[model samples]
Target: MEFKLNLTQEQKLIMTQQMQLSVKLLQMSNFEIQTYIEKELQENPVLDAEYKKNDNDKAQDEIDYKKLIKHLEFDNYGHSSYHRDDEEVSPFNFISAKKSLKEFLKEQIIDLNETDYIKSMCEYIVENINQRGYLGTSIEDIAEELTISQELSQRCLEIVQSLEPTGIGARDIKECLKIQLIEKDLKDENIFKIVDEYLELLAENKYNVIAKKLKITVQKAQEYGDIIKTLEPKPSRGFYTGEETKYIVPEAYIKKIDGEYHIIMNDGTIPKLNINGLYKKIINNEDDKQTVKFVKEKLNSAVFLIKSINQRENTIYNILEKILEIQKDYFEFGDEYLKPMTLKEIADNLEIHESTVSRAIREKYIHTDKGTIKIKDLFTTGISRVDSIEDVSTKIIKKEIQEVINNEDKKKPLSDQKICQLLKEKNIDISRRTIAKYREEMGIKSSSKRKRF
Candidate 1:
């Protein structure tokens, strides 16, 4: 074969800065959009804020309630409720906002006249708490991070565990319970023996085996077990200041109206902005060529920015439209109706790149009558086997394990193998190791640790 010059017609896609800007805007949250606008205003002298003419504008606008009501599409569920009252309070209690576990622990550490280094280590340990109040990191990991000795890290960890929630800095459930047991200094003489020797059996609620091995009565072992349950599992949870907690402001709202789902963009909360009239006038006015050129360039840039914002809004609307179409059942029924979806699926459906779909949904949300949900939540990884009745997400699996463990007879809790077998019977097809992992993720102890009288 001889080489020949040949050209073929093919689709070519290139990501330009304009396209990038549009994507960036699409992915930005409402707060982020405001910040971007503010930054643009500062940098571009031509972009200026349009202030309301105060009471005069309001008084004249009173005649037309439409001016007061932002342009929100009213659905059959009643006109999209817009609060004109500036005094509308947040649903969350502002005054009694709980302190984060890290800050609360830090406050206690401040009273200790230790060196800054030790204080810092304590803070790090507190910050790494898992949901159930375990440190979730090894001493070696902490030492490596801080470039400090493991001994020092352990010391700080010990101090943190000594705080109000007894097991705050434990590495695992066993350790967490052990710390609590050590703190309480209970009369259960065989507590340590039981924890070590029968933790796995205990985890399965194998109280009969535990009592037989420890030579203790079932009632006594249960008494000790009950004491362990009273300890705080997660010490660091619920510690955000009201002001610091970022609320999810949805970009769109989906409502069920007349036995049908309807979608609306939530542009009501965002403030409206336009090109500054003064700058537009200057651009239009005749001036020196250099001045005119500079003004025109800046004006073009501003227009591009506005166009990007508009494109971002349109892309979000289109993506939401597709999601509503695909997940119509979920909106109507609830989570159980959510079919497994992936980024690739949406990309294929919309004829957009996968990354574009990812960017479109990133940090974006849809407010439903149920609540504000992140767009990402709509896409779930499908389970390997499609025959299972249970939801395929690991979270759902973990929850089931937790529920099983929670209700297990203290004398006979399920073992990892048994849990795996049970899940298999239910078509979950999880291995014993996977069961163990789910158990750990749920902050559950092993069958031995779970053993009671």
Candidate 2:
């Protein structure tokens, strides 16, 4: 065997430490960036943070204290006031902590007049109910684990199901809906039959099949489907999850001034950074070579950090400006008017790579008059219509599909094919399969399931 060595020249992209930091900072959310800044502040002695004064603080500072004091002294100093009997404290004001679904269920179990043994069993069952208000363990499993009979465990489950939310202990979605229906006194022999036997058909929007089986008119079947739609599938849906709610802090604000959208970067939360004067003096003194070298290195790091933060802000601002230009209709008219966009489009416009655009918008949010929205939500793939030269956004198509379904006749609910045809009339040339895909994505049932009577 022989080994040969040859000099090879090739160009490869290399990211420096500062470059990596800039990329990392660009992708971080406002909360994450704040935490990172706090950590960096602790570690970097040369780097200092300057916080901006809040608007409320400035307003309070501008208040006339002498006038306020005079008004308070004259109005209330010698006056006798009676408390209004009708003005009671809100119950919500007394609540210091939110109860999880499990805690709420356990509280109900405690109030039950059942024996301690049954209550313990009920408590155990409640503990196993997942965040979705469905039992995580089977009755047989619970019975074997707790050394209780299946009958007793089943009764405990029934008791738990009877608790508020109407379907806490249901094994599955069908049982959940059935329990809700029963509670509302809306359950009949046919409703129970449809829930048990024809749930799949109901989901497919096959009202005709259901009507034929139940020997009822299409309108009557539609009534049953409508009633089912009113039931809450997710009974535990508004209860607090164990995890804390994440509130999005917007990095930029888009405001319409004189019928034109303007992009403003929010630097309010970002700390103003500068190298400590003492550290700069230590570097310039040159009295201690070692000390000078250390201070210089730290100073360089601090400068790079400041530059990276600025670069992050600039990149985000440019990206949002381009988005504003492209999605002007969305900004003016709302989500329904959102046009299809892509990372590549923004990257092309800004003369940056697709990955750069993605990083710049990742985990970042923008606030507009419409409300706070994720930066990524502004970009969607397009579906072109046959009649129109311009493309339609998938989001817009989904919204249109929902509208078509919402306005549809219950007895003659539009199937995916019919939906595709209807969309075609509006210049949306999508396939039946694509229509079905979009329909399902919006959680709409099939023609079979949609049929009523």
Best by lDDT: 2
Best-matching candidate per TM-score: 2
Question: What's the lDDT for all of these models?
Answer: 0.73, 0.85
lDDT of 2 at 341: 95
What is the C-alpha lDDT profile of model 1 across 242-286, one tens digit per residue?
246677888888988888887887765455566777766666678
For each of the candidates, the C-alpha root-mean-square deviation to the true structure, in angstroms, is 10.8, 6.2
Model 2 TM: 0.77
Model 2, position 12: C-alpha lDDT score: 100
lDDT of 1: 0.73
